[model samples]
Target: MSIICKYTIFYLSKPLNITTSSEAMLNQVRSVHNVRPPRMKYPLWYLQRERAKDDQQLTEDNRAFVKEAVHDKFGMPAVIHGISTYDVRSALREKSVEYENVEWSPKFQRTGLIARKLGNYPMWLNNGKSVLTTLLHVIDNHVIKYIPPGEFDPPRKPYSCPNHKKNLGCLLVGAESADPQYFTKQYCGLFYKEGMMPKKHLGRFLISPEAALQPGTPLMASHFNPGDFIDVRGKTIDRGFQGVMKRHGFHGMPATHGVTKSHRRGGNVGHGGEKGRIFPGTKMPGHMGNRYRIHKGAEILRINHKFNIIWIKGVASPGETNSIVYLYDTLLPLRKYKSSPPFPTSKVVEDDQLIDSYSEKMYKFTNQTITYEEEK
Candidate 1:
């Protein structure tokens, strides 16, 4: 009787060649409980995974010829010069020019600058306290293009601004001019309209339409003043696949007491009974760093106009030495500048004499020695 029962169950489990109404009904019922896979957030072309470095396979002579041709086409890289100081003063005097017409309000947002992290050093304060600062060099930056609010289209998935009515324009800024021969034609075309050389780094800044800058306008370290708080955005150093002990700072098992090979393992991932699955974001060991992080409210301790370098407070800024970082105004309400800062951008004269600007609290070596007086 047991054998007969087993044979009957096996026969029912096997798929039959003939399609029956009952089987069709069973399939339809199963389909109703099936969960669909998540859809892609961005378009296919948005991936842009193609290698940026192109191998042209050109000979040494061919490369030299290409370089010479590019040099002749766009002479030696133009010196980044700002609007004449006279013109800037005239605009302020007249009070009728465009610069005066569009005053920087609290609601207004301006463009950002691109800078390279050039390591860090310590600075002394007037109170005899030491503060570590990171040196950021702002290379030759230029305004590439400006897209108006209505025409500017960004990715829809990661919507930063909650308000739908706020129309923020987009400003394309490029830095570190490079030879055109190294970049592809499509990349070079971006700078062709402005008659500028191709840039190594490109950044997009969202700003109010009123702060729109003309293409080819130069951006320098003077865009930000000393003592103003700003935000630094950069990619963190890439520390590939790491263990939980280092990555998540997990406390491993005791070295003694006969602990086996599971010292660094994240034991007991899921509960045994009802809640059988592991929860998401469980801080398990995986690929770490190489993420876009923003270090906010870093005060500008010093500014060097001669070399276009900015000394920002703190050595904890994201990224390793010599990595690219983006600088913009801080969003922190308390740290936000009460007065307007270089609306559109700062303009300087060719014969400008300002070399270094330092914060009041900072102790400059050039100043006289401090003297302590006895109380009267």
Candidate 2:
């Protein structure tokens, strides 16, 4: 008896399909109903036939059975019957999880359980617009290491830490150049095994073990799809301490002929006569900036699936130019998100020869138009 299951990282209320032009059949799928998250190569579907079932055997009558029996239990798709028992550890490893900063929210650890754990966040359009224009860095990032789950080695979390493994989750990869001395011999060997050059940054994504990929995988912008909700995590610009006037925006003493010295100075801080004490949280700024931040629920404008790059909403992505940032699917609910985004995920077939071809006309900031159309 075959089965199907779909354990979505997001809520995904609408029906889903993944059809692409590369496939002779429906390999990738898109829809008018809703815009889904970017399509990363997740090893979520692994089907190894017990006795090599043929294509004709998987008929409509059989699809219904597969849905009710397998998909119902495992949350996999209907047509994944004759596939191999692929590993999911690598998918989780490939993911570079973006977490909400600790200062902004105390439930930092809780977020780990919140994303793909609680429910999927919905995708939404910004300012009632259907499409958006954003930035994407199409770097040649490669998967240097594939640490399968259950077989994960050291560097495990101290129990004080939430998700910590030797390799943590699964595939660890990132942009160009990694400093070899900073890593151990064993760790460096993993990258070599994949025949990948050292990466500048490496992160492990937590994907379903059943749908993981092998080591030495070349990753690019094509990993993500257009119109998905991804949370951006990065370091905010650092601003040193300042007085209440600068930090809290307190209107300091006016600069007048007589009040020259008091200008920009915080007025009498303590209530000398009554309280004789400085209250807590008294907007007296000491240090500022240089904190980790997350721009939650940012909408993806477009995804160059061939490039493994995505363009997201808002220019508030933390850090200055070239600072490393982590982007992940938003871990929020549908009702709480902005409206007008695609309800379900999308997929489309591509050139059979180019499974990882880059998009020529990618979504650019110049392409984004404002709501200033002249009525004819």
Candidate 3:
């Protein structure tokens, strides 16, 4: 890696202007761009400017005021519990289409749920193979509101297409229930109409019109079945102000014989002349991670109904432990389901009694040790 970087620097140092160039060999002399420190010809969103001096002071003062007020008046709101008037089971029964009648077409898209990442654990398969799996718990998820396709308007942004057509509605999903007394009146008002407690984390999922769920509808772990493939979306861990070596995996200048002071530097960005300015997408030292990303086609290994936890087949599922994530059906070409999924989400039957569900290859904790048949 170091050798490759050295060769690149050597190549970039060659003078683009051959006629006015020095007579001395190009390799012997270092170009000004090669020896000098790299500077940003362009700045990204976060690094454009510095905040005002009073901004930090104002934020700290506001935080203190809120803290003191809560202590003096509310004294930490208690966990309010109550039943919702909207009967979910009865509402489903009244629908014109029966459970079997509502078919899952290949074109149909499903709604997603917000889950909290609960770290990871190791599991052994029946074939003596061990696999690492991440635990994502669905934490008191409920549909707050649904905006139909005609009413939905995509956010106006430079990256977004201004003329893009809207074919799906948006479902406001929230997780990790919280009390309303601590929040502002405007914030609490959003949940008041839905008859729900304030949620710690809320996310919006764009789902087709046919998959639109009613407000106050509860979502559970069974929304996905064992062996199903899901897409996990979350913000990756924030790595602030990193160097080229750590951020871009670039091999720095060697740290020995004749090398001095330029050990960790990213040498040379350009050659002098027509193509003079540093390229826009050149990898350099800057902010790293903390971006929203989706890990597609992660297999669901197992699920526990009592705890509302699911074991998915990847340790690299984004987000730190206890952080919120959005789980949805995979839109990948080959991984998409051939048969029907849990259409319109799974129903909670009062008489049904299954504590745990596992995929065929998974080894259950409650089961006996594995034994293979003797060779013939």
Among the numbered candidates, top TM-score falls to 1
lDDT tens digits by residue: candidate 2, 117-188: 111222234344443334545444445444555665434345454455333345455444433334445555
Q: What TM-score do all the candidates reach, one by one?
A: 0.77, 0.47, 0.71
Writing each residue's lDDT as its tens digit, candidate 1 over 1-376 gives: 6564444444643564333544554455545444445555542113232237867899999988886777677664445432111111011122211333487888888899998899999988887788999999887778877777776765552344545534887788888777766666767877776666777888889888888877777888989999999999999999999999889898888877999998987666777677888888788889999999999999999998887899999987899999999999999999998999988789854546777889999988787776667899
Best of the two (1, 3) by lDDT: 1
| Candidate ordering by TM-score (highest first) | 1, 3, 2
Pitting candidate 2 against candidate 3, the one with the higher TM-score is 3
lDDT against true structure, model 2: 0.46
What RMSD, rounded to one decimal, does every model reach? 8.6, 25.7, 14.0
> Per model, how many backbone clashes are there?
0, 72, 0
- The Cα local distance difference test for each model comes to 0.77, 0.46, 0.73
User: Residue 65 of candidate 3: its Cα lDDT?
Assistant: 80
Point out the higher-scoring one by lDDT: 1 or 2: 1
For model 2, the superposed segments whose C-alpha errors exceed 4 Å read 1-134, 148-170, 177-187, 208-211, 245-253, 257-259, 265-282, 304-309, 335-376
Q: List, residue by residue over 310-350, the lDDT tens digit for candidate 3.
A: 99998988889988899999988898888888777787644
Model 3 steric clash total: 0
